[model samples]
Target: MSIHLFQISLTQLQGVGPQKAEELHALGISTVGDLIEYYPFRYEDYRVREMHEIKDGERITIQGTIASLPTMQRFGGKTRLICRVTVESMLVTAVWFNRAFLKEQLTPGREITLTGKWEQRRRQMTVADSEFPDKGGAKTGTLQPVYSVGGSLTQASIRKMINQALIQFGALIPEILPAELLEKHALLPRRSAITRIHRPENTLEGQEARRRMVYEELFLFQLKLQAYRATHMKQADGLVHPVNNEEIRQFVSRLPFELTGSQKQVINEILHDMKQPYVMNRLLQGDVGSGKTVVAAVGLYATVKAGHQGALMVPTEILAEQHTRSLGAMFEPYGIQVGLLTGSLTERKRRDLIASLQMGLLDIVVGTHALIQEDVYFRSLGLVITDEQHRFGVNQRSILRRKGMNPDVLTMTATPIPRTLAITVFGDMDVSTLRERPKGRKPIKTYSVKHNMMDRVLGFIRKEAEQGRQTFFICPLIEESEKLDVQNAIDLHMQLTHALPELAIGLLHGRMNAAEKEATMATYAAGETNVLVSTTVIEVGVDVPNATLMIVMDADRFGLSQLHQLRGRVGRGEHQSFCILIADPKSENGQERMKAMTDTDDGFEISRRDLEIRGPGEFFGTKQSGMPEFRLANLVNDFEVLEQARDDAAALTASESFWSSQSYKELRDNLNRDAKQQTEPLD
Candidate 1:
């Protein structure tokens, strides 16, 4: 009759049969600990309304009586009920479609309270999701928790299960934070917080509980990051590539374009890190097309010149191939050999390449995750760089790092996170940013348009194609999805082909295999495909300089950084590139994203706006190497708490007793587990 804490499965709980357990498991709540962590995404305040306060477009509660029986009729195979409810003195029409069953509840002189949205234009109110209470039964104000449900799950069911858990195991949940720390921050105890989160008595209590949960989440995250840094710093000496080598200087001098000051400054920082004895674990952050690849190439060349090998791991095969082709061309005159390893290589050719790498015949190598295969080996690898590293998982980077003995690690990201967010997210690594685009790269012209201007946009793309340029149409989905109402790549491609039959259009998405994607991209890059229709899968490693127009459908569905990346795909080419957003977003946040994209082409500014609107958990999602969904914390509102947690972690970790204390054994174990569970991407 005892609960085993985090290990106890949800199936063991009362009334939780196999079907119920499966539903919970789908939501990542297989165990008691996960259930405790599955906080509600939102809460509804059930405020009882005064009848006089009814207004158009407002959600209000009305205490009323059914003036007469509602009229039920069938219209086009659907039943509808119409009634006039008397609220105090005003009688307003209430309608329900396909709910003739509710006609029984609208008996004459029946008294009730109804809550729903009032639409003035429709001249009626709907009761689809409204809550009702018996009239004169003394309605009570309350708050209800609404969870993210799917499949067979429902919000009411989840709330019921959580309340059951609170009754059974709430008090037994252990507290990990020190008493002094809790008192200093005015945080509620762990047990009290969990109970209040599930079943709070009032609004104020719920806020206090949520605040405590946010603080704990932030504190644990910072504590683990500090531990990871401490662990990494204790590693053995790393290989050094002496800075200011003649080969490096000569390579930079030979490039076609001059390096911007920001690029130069970042190169200095990276070179300085490489020359140091300790492992150079640095993050290179730049906006899309800010010359990050060139800097990475220079670092790789420096390591090769020092008589060591270099490896660049990218996320996709197309990107890997592009880097290999470009870097091979750039390094050929310098006598440094560049190699490629990918899933698409034939067996014999791949084996020969592996042998050459093992024998140190190749000076530099570019590859997808294939480089992390067991057979791949490097001869004295000194530097490891991951391109668009956000596309990679933390373990993938660590595995590549293990290929070389304490190699200097440099991770690059094109997402321009604010400096403050960067500190909290990548606190374990030194950060260098490239804030400038290379000279001669024209700023992209962005325009936001509604769906009504579709024909005009199509004509614009046709015009660009007539000039021997290309265009990209980005959709949010690879195929039609039941849940998502946005356009899909397949549907868009078909529609575009019908609209412009003369132009050669191509289709690309993430679901396409390595060979298929490569072929599709090849045709597009060769200008044979005048218009390429794709999903956001083309977000990374797609370079078509001749492609001048990027039209994103459902543009509001994408984050600002993501939209910027898609916009970047077009502006890479000269000829006054343009990005057209086809959108009419329904939500305020979506409208904000659309406005931000049209306001400026600056990635950093867009990123700041993205973080503010979407929050950090989503800002760093799966496509961009996000951490776990934070249940409580706001990266913007709680930035001060983040700073405090970071300071506390650093100060506590520096203390001798921090690791040795017996009281922190559970906490230490949790930190290690969290570090392994989350992917740490460079911002």
Candidate 2:
């Protein structure tokens, strides 16, 4: 009677023929174990109710006798069924749209039960679910699981299939979780949890099942991340180069303004990491105008002073050029040689830069992914820094690290992740935060407007342009498609160019070539182009101090962090900048999101609220980003579970024989299979 004795084949399920089995395999539900773990998205309750007590618009079940024979008719290609029933002398009408078969099932003078929403229309009590009493036996007071289904597989069909499978395999249930771990987490037995989740007798049972499964999923993911951190820390040892603050002090002393307290604190943290024996894999997270670049420059200066090279990798050529120009100006006074390399550079220029980089003549090289190309070699690479770390994957970051003998890594991001998520996802790296903006920087006045205010907004823009100020118009899409998003870059550029031909208008999008993009950005930055119309491609780079006006059309289509980044493009100058979010205020969610933008200028607050509303998976694109994707545990709604799971994982991994434990073995096998199964079909 061992729990592990269960070994039911999926083919044994009723109505699951070979073809259906193959189709299920395509969705990665090939075995009983996989099917059991395929959790439902939501649940439905089917508790019965008294006919007289049933409230209007409330879905319920009431027993009644048919007063009149049901009538079925087709109206405008849609079938409709209507019938009258009596419950204790109270007559109630039931109507069903597209359920004509119900007319024959509920005949006159027959006692039956109806389950659906009761609606009062034109002084008549009408019910919606038009089904007979015998077919209503599936009703349960507990939460009924609702799953995601595809073509031809309705919810009822899926429920029936799963029920059949469960019935056939019920006696063969297995206990996959270790007894100690289950007890520690107060998790239910695996077999009982799975059974209850699909067909719960009560709401509490269903909730307990969900809680247990969520904990298991999050615990396993945290364990994997913790194990990765532990393995990397033990193997990759970093050289601790003591920081000589003299060089950084000299550079800072010549600055026009004093560094903010937050900036100085972050620099101190970076300096401390540089003195540590472990490799400095740290993320410098700050708001838009928090001056993360200067902190990173300090790290570069310190690394160069330690007799090693540093490389700053940006996502685009324009960002690379901007970083190179700024860093060159900052470090040249200290005699630090900074070089720029990009894909758009001439062959001869790139070759010359590569030679200097190999010869160790370039102390710091700032560029795009070109810095990690095979042709470019670093002589004494000591530190590697990447801006907008989310744009690159782990393998790409590892490739850059391979340039040197385990170079200390420093990653920077303007998108401020929540503290809890940061600790879990980036547990391997130390973190530094710059929370304050530089002095004299004005907060951009943000407003949400509808399309009707387009003309007025343009007029304001014209005024700003006349005053020698620059403007940026951000569009959600690059080109005109048949989509609902009407304000695309191409169309908007044409409209604006025609409207304001007196001012220079330039276009920048992802489809444009590198040279074209760089040229357009350069024209805008140099004040040659007074207006720039672009897509989200301009979200990361193209910093212009003269651009004082920002307008994002259909701002509701953009994420909070993306909108914040686009807004960051402006307010870099002294003039009072404005961000106009043009969106339809009729949509509640859209209004709520844009209101968040208009209310606060804090990027971290926006990100936190975004995570709370949409969850971290959507905020960071964790599924596509190759980070651990959870099925049930949401970082926002299930915050407690996430924290507990992380703690449990840390404790379990700290044990000497943790990796050799039965639970760890199963978890590792599951992870390996998950990775492999992603490449090919399940079958």
lDDT of 2 by residue, 1-683 (tens): 12232244567787888776676677667676566667788877666566567666776767678899878879899997788888677888777788776666777888776667777553244455434555555553445689887756677777887887778776666564567779988899877888888888877898898898888777767676666666666454787777888767887778777899999998888888887888777888998878988888888988888899999988888788889999999887778999999888899999999999999989999988887788779998989999998887666677888899778889899999887677656765677888998998999999999999999998988999999999999998887777574688998999999988898999999999988887888888889999999988888866799999999998888888889999999999789999999998887778878978888999888988888767666877853243455667777678788778777877777787676866556665654544421221000
Clash count of each predicted structure: 0, 0
Using Cα atoms with residue i matched to residue i, what is each candidate's TM-score against the true structure? 0.68, 0.84
Model 2 quality (TM-score) = 0.84
Rate residue 216 of model 2 by lDDT.
76
RMSD value for candidate 2: 4.6
lDDT of each: 0.82, 0.79
- The candidate that wins on TM-score is 2
> Compared with the true structure, what per-residue lDDT tens digits does model 1 show for residues 639-663?
7888888888877777777899887
What's the CA error at residue 82 for candidate 1, in Å? Answer: 12
